[model samples]
Target: MASKYRRGFDITRDSLRVFTREPSLILLPVLSLLAVGSAFAVLTAIVFQQGLVESLVTNDLYQYGALFCAIAISSSVATFFNAAVVHCAAQLFDGNPTSVRDGLAAAWRARRQIAVWAVVAATLGTVLYILDEKFGVVGSLTRAVFNLAWALLTFFIVPVIVLDERRSLRRQLRRSGSLFRDTWGESVSATLGVSFVFLLVALPGVALGAVGFFVLDGILATGALVSGGVIIVAAIVGSQTASAIVRTALYRYATTGEGVGPFENRDPDTVFPES
Candidate 1:
């Protein structure tokens, strides 16, 4: 138990150190959220203002098409910013300084590939949605299995998109899968470490929020709730940034046999071992 906590602490500390060194890294995820939220808002407006709700409900083809568009819009936005984050981390890990602009530029350079990937992901997502919505318990079970497989297979796709040479999406998928097959253990461990650390950070705020919502009253409750919300949001951003850093470092190490940024001076085996 103690060792587990220590490992989490070490991973969290290192990831945070990288973030402190490159504070602009936070902007990528923030931009992703804003863009995705806007896309969702537009879709909602179209549904309500344009009277697509009934069409969306009754027409299978139209409903699927709309869902596909919604998924593609949100997924593409998120993926593009993720590519930006990966690109920035790539530079940072290489001992070069970077900015939000540089990261955005890198992602833009790969815009076509990212769009193709978004379409691929959205198609699969739509099929899964249809399955779960139309097929009952068997569809739910199949969706769960397929979703897990999809996540594992595409684990390194963002960094691969940013860093790999222009290749077909199938090739990129193979590359990601190959890398995962080689480093799955270390990757999973480091991700869990980051998650565990952030969970610890989030718990106090969660408790405070629960208290404010249930056990407290009036201004005291409002203050507690607000405080908790801030803490939780900060924790979320921190975790997202930290997780990205970890993924980038692991990708760099797996592909190039070298660590970058926070993993620079430490033995890769100490944190992210080769298996």
Candidate 2:
């Protein structure tokens, strides 16, 4: 357990280093946010025009359908950019220079696979949402468990899709699950570390925002709020970039029996124990 935590910290630290070296990586998450937001806006507009919004509000079935579509579209956009980020991270791992343009091109090339995976993800999300909405407490518990399982199973799907575009979506998902099972169960620890780092990064901004709301007034308060918002956005972008880098490194190590970044020179057995 201690070793797992140590490995998680190392992964997070190395991922941060990669992000520092290539600051442009942050743009991937930023663009992903913008793309998803735009898609949601468009979807909302279309749904409203078609009177689906009213139906969604009044009818459970319509609501679920709308929710599923929204989740699917947003998730798909995110998956596209995540794939691009993974592509760029892979290049960095290989000691090759890659631009955001190159990464975007790679993602575009694998658009079909991304689309299919997005549908799968969306379906899972919708089912979970429906479970929570229909079954009350029991459904909510089931949804939570399934959500975590889904996350674990598909953790490496983006890297697999980016690296091996020829594989079918089902195969890619299965491969991701298999690779994760073969790994040293570091996902929970790594996630906790990343979340802790994000909290640290966002703390100042949150403090400022709270101060602005409670103590500051007028222009000073507005300035503080704006600054806080910017800082929070930066923190989110940084966290996302680091996560992608770490995930890509993990996938590489899992598949090639080699490591990049801080993982280099580390024993594979130590990283992924045979227990």
Candidate 3:
């Protein structure tokens, strides 16, 4: 059994490993671009929803409720696609020998599970948003920590659903969650660490977008538009690459005994049942 508490690995180190081991993982970068683009579209929809709700909810309470519901549905769909992309990237980077079409196909195959997970994640976020608005909970450190912990804890769920074809939804989630629990610190460190680097690389683009906005007097200037667009694309690509790395790490740990604990104890016979 995987000891679950294995250490000495993280996202940054894992990413470094991938880059060094297989620099030809071009699909990761492409997946990142696609994921980020989809995210941008989803964000735009949410923003538009708030504006629409404000404009249309002057007298009708039901209209406001309906708008919010629509936004939630749209957000969930975007999240499902994003999760799918992450799974695809992970499989590709892990030497799964798949294409973008394979990634999409994987998502389609696991659509139900992905959709369920999306709704759950979005509902959590929405609840936090509600609390922030209704009870002035925005500054609560506990809330912040809760959100952070939840995000990291469930990081492996989608990838598990996408990559583990032999298992059903319940088993896949349970197994992934268990694997993650055993490797919690490592997972968090790697995920957050890589995300930080991505943010650092993206910061300059954000600054340029800000300059564009100001230079254009709050209107979208050419520079701002270009900068923002580039930043978004970079974010997407980075995300996809990161997903591939995480998937590789988990799958390896699960099947090949790459990490600490249960990973090492994996039955070689079970690891490659077909071989």
Tens-digit lDDT track of model 1 for 1-275:
66766776787788768757678778888878778878898788978998888988899998899989988998798889888888887786677999999999999999998999999999999999999999999999999999999988988888888898847999999999888887887778878888888888889899999999999999999999998987887777778777877888888888888867656776556664432
Error in Å for residue 128 of model 2: 1.5
TM-score ranking from best candidate downward = 1, 2, 3
lDDT of 3 by residue, 1-275 (tens): 12121222234345545444334444545554555557667755875876764644563544445445554565455445545555544554545655556556766777777666656665666566555555665535556876877766566766676666634556765767776776665565545555666676678888777778677754468858797868866775665566555555655565455642222333322332222
In model 1, what are the clashing residue pairs, if there are any?
none
Query: Against the hidden reference, what TM-scores do the models get?
Result: 0.87, 0.86, 0.64
For candidate 1, what's the RMSD?
A: 2.9
The root-mean-square deviation over C-alpha atoms between each candidate and the true structure, in angstroms, is 2.9, 3.1, 8.3
Error of 1 at 168 (Å): 1.2
Residues 1-275 of candidate 2 have per-residue lDDT tens digits of: 66655565666777877756677777889998888878888887888788786787899888878878887888788889988988988888888888889899999998988888888888888888888988999999999999888888888888999996447977888889988888735554455667677878799999999999999999999999989988998888777777777778778888887878656656544554534
Q: Model 2, which residues run further than 4 Å from truth?
A: 1-10, 19-21, 44-54, 265-275
lDDT value, candidate 1, whole model: 0.84
Give the better candidate number (2 or 3) by TM-score: 2
